[model samples]
Target: MGKKRVIQQTEEELIQETTEIEQKLQGDVKVAKSGLREGRIYIKSTYNNTIMTLTDDKGNTIAWVSAGKIGFKGTKKGTPFAASKVAEALSAAIEKVKVSKVMIYVQGVGTGRDTALRTLAAKNIDIIGIKDITPIRHGGCRPPKVRRV
Candidate 1:
């Protein structure tokens, strides 16, 4: 491979990107002005995309965001950068709802899983707990039938 080139986005482009993510989030969930104190953030990451949903303690979805909805396309949707963007957008919604304590439930084995958590932490939300809810097989596949004589 030849030298790698880093393409830089101008301020206008960066702002546009963020605006798109915000639009998607706003459309997904219209947070009530009543304000919420405790809630849950469910991050469902897959090989193709990372989706995050914010819900009140009662499990009502307040907002949700995803890499594709944040302007990432094709394979880029699965990238860690996209994941951080998703987190940023969600944090904005989280703050809007005035939620003080947040419980994060992470699922899936995707590239974005860890990056999203780090970005959310940097945004200064009062993250109370982090749990990995990824499902796992309890037992190995059944033993193969005995070889033919």
Candidate 2:
């Protein structure tokens, strides 16, 4: 029986790797604004998670935040409180872009949906419109057979 040996890096190679990483990090530090005004907010709230995305009027996404993205874990990510935090974080990004009004398109039957909208309002962002895009069951999909006893 023998133990396997691991590969070791030379000092120069290690220095090169570190410098590359630093350069990549610096490249990612740009400001958020892209010279746009009015935008749309898309909210998808599910039983287990809430995701909010901000996009320009042309539907190009500018920024996004989710309950899980804001550090909520497991079941807590679906709560209204977590949703509010996600909205708050996103509002700051939106404000930086000077977006005064937003047309919110919300799709879901989750508890966080309304709370997120309220948080945005409290942040002083104008609510141009709120549209519910939740899909309705028009007798969707065939149901599975009843379970046998």
**lDDT (0 to 1) per candidate:** 0.86, 0.80
lDDT of 2 by residue, 56-77 (tens): 8877778887876666668988
What number of clashing residue pairs does each candidate have, in the order they appear?
0, 0
Q: Which structure among the candidates has the greatest TM-score? A: 1
lDDT value, residue 9 of candidate 2: 88
Model 1: per-residue Cα lDDT over 9-119, one tens digit each: 999998987787667655644565447888999999898999999988888888888888767879989989889889988888887788888999999999999999999
Highest-lDDT candidate = 1
Q: Tell me the deviation in Å of residue 110 in model 1.
A: 0.4
Clashing pairs in 2: none
Alpha-carbon shift of residue 88 in model 1 (angstroms):
0.3
- The root-mean-square deviation over C-alpha atoms between each candidate and the true structure, in angstroms, is 5.5, 9.5
**What TM-score does structure 1 among the candidates reach?**
0.75
